[model samples]
Target: MKARDRDDEGRARSARPRDGLGRPLPYGAPGVGRQPEGVVRRPAETVAEAQRLLDDGMPFHAHEVFEDAWKSGPAVEAPLWRGLAQLAVGLTHAARGNTVGGARLLRRGAVGLAGVDPAHGIDVAALVRWARELADRVEAGAVVDAAREAPVLGGGGRGRRLE
Candidate 1:
């Protein structure tokens, strides 16, 4: 194909998928890197994907994906995804210097996650701690730090890094 065929109004057609990440998926592959059909997508998978997006600095996308899963998954697992998604969104906002939004979202996420069991992949205590810290900082009018505190896996705060 000629260069002109790849261009629309002088802008070259992107060879990559719309995600900032490079590469176009092959035929039948999902657009966002994960296929949505027939696969058993647990809340853990949704949270993990959300974490990846957050790490890539795409908080909004992360929140959206988790929200989708939270709405459709089992009730026992929905809060986990919802809470985590909000947490990521809050962090994104904080990174962007929006302390108020960050605090609000974080606290809301924590509230949404309260009383949920960790076995369901929801770390309620850690989330509550994170929310409290953020809320305190926001209340004191402290600057939002771009660095995110990592989530711990297991009761002893060991085993694996959640983010």
Candidate 2:
């Protein structure tokens, strides 16, 4: 096997190109640009950026944004961000046609989100419900459309209103 790439700190990293869904492509294949990890953002910024990516049907990129929030935000908010990240990944998997994997992650994310307080401006209840329902649909052989069903992540539950 070829040697895996490593970062400056010797942590495993890939400089590989990735499709919109974050799937690795051949070395020279064109792919989406990735957001740099560890850039801290305020809660609103994180939500807004993630919402935009989801609207663009780029759940994997949105997942990375939430991941940054989970890692760089306060410990208390880690679960919330992490749950959101997982939710995005679930969407990514579903869109890519990984039914079982998608449903599993969606359920996991919903479980994590269920325990969080809703004072963070995210409609946690709606998200949990959406995740559960989507998981069910996905399991029943529904085709996932990430953009068309992207959840409204902000606006006091009014933002990113789904059409």
Residue-wise lDDT of candidate 1 within 1-163, one digit each (tens)? 7343264456565443433222255545555543232234575666566555555555556667767877777777777777877876776666566778878888888887788777545467776776667667776776654334434323323222443
Writing each residue's lDDT as its tens digit, candidate 2 over 53-111 gives: 89888899999999999999999998899999999999999999999999999999999
Q: What lDDT does each candidate get?
A: 0.60, 0.89
Please give the range of 10 consecutive residues that has the lowest summed lDDT in model 2.
Answer: 154-163
Question: Which stretches of model 1 miss by more than 4 angstroms?
Answer: 1-40, 120-122, 145-147, 150-163
Residue 91 displacement (Å), model 2: 0.6
TM per candidate comes to: 0.60, 0.91
